[model samples]
Target: MELDLFRWRFVHWQFMLTRPSNYTAGNIGGSVSGVKIAFLGNGSYAFTVTGNSNPDGSIYNSEEAITSQTTGRLYGAIFVRHWDSYITPQRQTIFYGSLKKDGSQYALSKVVNVLKGTNLESPVPQFGSTDNFDVSSSGIAFVSKDPVLQPAIFTKINAYFVPLTDFTVASPPSPIQIQTSGFNGQATSPVFSPDGKQLAFLRRKSVQYESDKLQLFVLTDVAEPNSTINALPTADQKGAWDRSPSSVFWSPDGKTLYLTAEEHGRVALFTLEPPSVTANSSSLPKKVFYDGAISSAYPLSNGDVFISGSNLVDNSIYFHYDSTSGKSNVLSSNAKNGTVFGLSRSQISEIWYPGAAEGTQIHAWVVKPSNFSATQKYPLAYLIHGGPQGSWEDSWSTRWNPAVFAEQGYVVVAPNPTGSTGYGQGLTDAIQGEWGGLPYEDIVLGFQYIEENLDYVDTSRAVELGASYGGYMTNWIQGHDLGRKFKALVTHDGVFSMVSQLASEEQWFPDHDLEGPYWKNPSSWLKWDPSAHTANWSTPHLIIHNELDYRLTIAEGLAAFNVLQQRGIESEFLSFPNENHWVLKPENSLLWHTAVLDFINKHVGLPTYSEQSSYAKQLRSEAWQNRKGDLGRKV
Candidate 1:
């Protein structure tokens, strides 16, 4: 083993691209779309379908989990994004084919078939570009771009309709012109109406505008060339970005449209009625229902809408008002376990996690401070979750707190933005490869949203911190911008150098390789590489990690500390030799939290030198050995 280790060091870079055979569930797209979940496999796969059959009379080959119901077709990304780049069979094309009863398969029966374009000879690119595809009642519609950088403007909404004979050659009739002149803003949250005749989408607000508003636009005859479209006004006359209109779906009746309004730091479900043109050719919108606490809502074809609430304990339980029975039961009440509110009395408002963004209905929890008072201004600690895929569920977290942060005179805003799961495939796929891009924007915008709309926050005194991926983001944010916004930062076991992470021959190296061969695309890796711009980092930071964490490894933390020292930055490093990916044990957690409080106090203008001195000394000795290049040296 020692000899092998030595050999690995000599040629560590060789194993940089040796990733797992294929992307794991981690690489799978986010939230489940329709009721018919799909999966991708290398021709060998198995699944079960209930009360469903393919056109070929075979039981559907289901692999991925879809969350919609009987009447509607679901959509999911075929490819997924990896660390610094995109992956393919991209989310749009990589779909699993379900089998029909008589042993026949649908168009997407096999993973290979999904990857093969009309021309089955050439394999698809494993990197670059992000797209979402949908097959509506009318036909198949795909949202793609000629150049990824050019706003993901909706190019063409396709319609493929043919009789049973032409099913084999089902091709699009023609391209629909949604935004012909090109939407001034980027195209996001595109959804087709029930009839597939019209398309509804969110036009993101520009960066210069300092607003995250989205406006709802309708493209009628979307599958036809030179179609008519209109950006409809809401009854409130408010812009969409603030409360960006999303999760847009036409009701089963098709008379009303359901949309989520996420703005003013609140997510509400709103129902809209399209305008009727008068002699002046103007239309009016009427509001139906608004539920602010329900920030993210999805309407199911079963006449049920699953809305994620801000309450910790019951954050997400399917909800519906039985118009017929006048009775409602929270769907899956059995799934709720007081996991979100372990502390009992804490009033959690929302929750956040690793992959979510602002304006995104991420899973999060907010607890009012103990002995709270409206007159008091509180501090904040923006807590982040790990996993770039892990969720900050209603479950108890050993990490940051709603009550604890609030008790510490801080308000916490945890948002699960673009990359978070439990939402659906489209939202999850959006964050792939866009790690630093969309995720960062979501975090910043979420923070800004809280400061603007929430009254209890003390923005100037807020701090940001996280572990693993969260730590990586902390380091990324600190290096990118620190205009005294975050009073302090704590990053635990974060990857500081993409170059080192790529070169290391560890268990993680293979999984990390899922990003694609760095040799093939250095630009993608650089885009999310925190170490690339460490030279610009100036924020006081606390580096924490477990000595035995193979996932991130101790060397990564040391590298970050060394870089900070080299730059004369105010920082400290902490480690738990007995811990792993997380500081799990109770004693370790207490110590960890104590150290964190001490660090925050010192950095947030309160001194805790006496309490932190001993730990500081211990870290200095350990850090100094590495600093002086003494440990790894063979004297």
Candidate 2:
């Protein structure tokens, strides 16, 4: 059924693109006359079918349709803006935009501000809409700021609602705050039940040591005019913290709620069942879908769902999950098309290995060479991800593509060890204040596991590479006994010293990860500081740093190179003066990749320079000059 719908939609889109003469100019400025299909948060869809010019020179909507085919209903449009101008100070606000439908034609109301003269500061209010607003059926209840209270006492932004009927006049009514007893952090992503009697939202708490922990709450009796908006008691489950929950959606029956969160290294679907009683419940949220991290999900009236996410091999694809059969079917192409860029024929697989502790499992992604054979050995390129709290999701990346390594005849392994998100919050928080502890051990064990299990992987000819947190890990690896494990190491924009890294622009990162300032926890700084262990470093290294990287600072990379050079250890530094922490420009990226590949090839016995690809040779020359005459040394 979804396949047919997709085909029809594809045909319609193609037809709309071909027939340029049929589209008339819209009042909204751009050419928006074509049928633009937009999915609403209420599990339904809307489209601007056709447009026609009115007799008075103004354009009138010839056809504007909303689908009532789903279990959800459409509310009036809500427009939100981050108003930062001379007239209004920097503040985030939502406006009510009424919808008037006449036959197939509909008109949108002029936006009326929901909050007027409200001095709300940072940690702004969210209307549960990144794309479309999460509004009640009557278009009255919407998520906004609690305007009655100033941001001084309540430093955290709280979620509130304003009814549509309150905007009969020019001035809008004050929003009613949803009260959560223990939660004082910002509230966002409010999802109203289909019956419009209950509201579900996430409440987060600001902690000094780590990220804000989010807990799901449902407000009952929301329809009552003078109801005391108390959230139902929820369980405080450890390791259940949400890692980037983007959207909140309720089932058609309103008994179940679905959301996607990073759990143990993938974005998996979680289901929460609101307790029947108001008392604190011990029912924990269960993970329903485990295939991959679901970026977005849209539920249908017939208990089925449409999801978009990435897996081990493929990047982004659409799937339809049948609730009855408990199975999912692909609805989109297996791989993206139309790109002529010669990508390698690589196969990706998810591998689980023993972690730092016994019986503990760590997840890693392996990308093998195109013509892979068990009889032939291949060098390994270990790629680490950033975020310390981030995971190597089964997603495609242009910057650190593992396939590119495979194209060079090297097997690539990307791991989401301890402290990586998508596993569980407990695992993510494990490395807090212990950056070089369990996570490092996990990476070592992951590599050892691959060496022992994969016969085709030549671990002795391996190179470890990473950027950001991964860079820090590479630096950390250089200082530990693991330095002897790899033939070479590459660090890009990595942290060299804990105390020096404190000079980073984002103080919150070190503050949260290190458990406070360096002065406050000098022991923590000394324990894992890579600079402190430079005496143990012996491996050949390549250091890459960007001048615009204020996060780790250019000094971090320079310091690492200085130590290696001062000690007479084989080392090279490549500086990108015009780039940031990431080399984003196309030409710069080509140079970066060429330099990295050259370094890897020199160590792994591959052709250091490819004459067949003149473009690559030219990039290698440019990158060598950027090395500041250091290319003469044995790489």
Best by TM-score: 2
For residues 323-440, what per-residue lDDT tens digits would candidate 1 score against the true structure?
Answer: 2353544554322533443433345566443334434455555666555677877777787776565445443334554455655556666767665544543454465567677777
Candidates' RMSD to native: 15.4, 10.2
| TM-score against truth, every candidate | 0.48, 0.75
lDDT of 2 by residue, 45-75 (tens): 3322122223222223324323347654343
Quote the lDDT for 549 in model 2.
Answer: 74
lDDT of 2: 0.65
Q: Worst lDDT window (10 residues) for model 1?
A: 158-167
Tell how far residue 624 is off in model 1, in angstroms: 14
Give model 1 RMSD, 1 decimal: 15.4
After superposing candidate 1 on the true structure, give the runs of residues whose Cα lies further than 4 Å from its correct spot. Answer: 1-82, 85-131, 147-178, 204-213, 233-242, 275-296, 300-304, 310-315, 321-404, 407-488, 491-540, 544-560, 563-570, 573-635
Whole-model lDDT per candidate: 0.50, 0.65
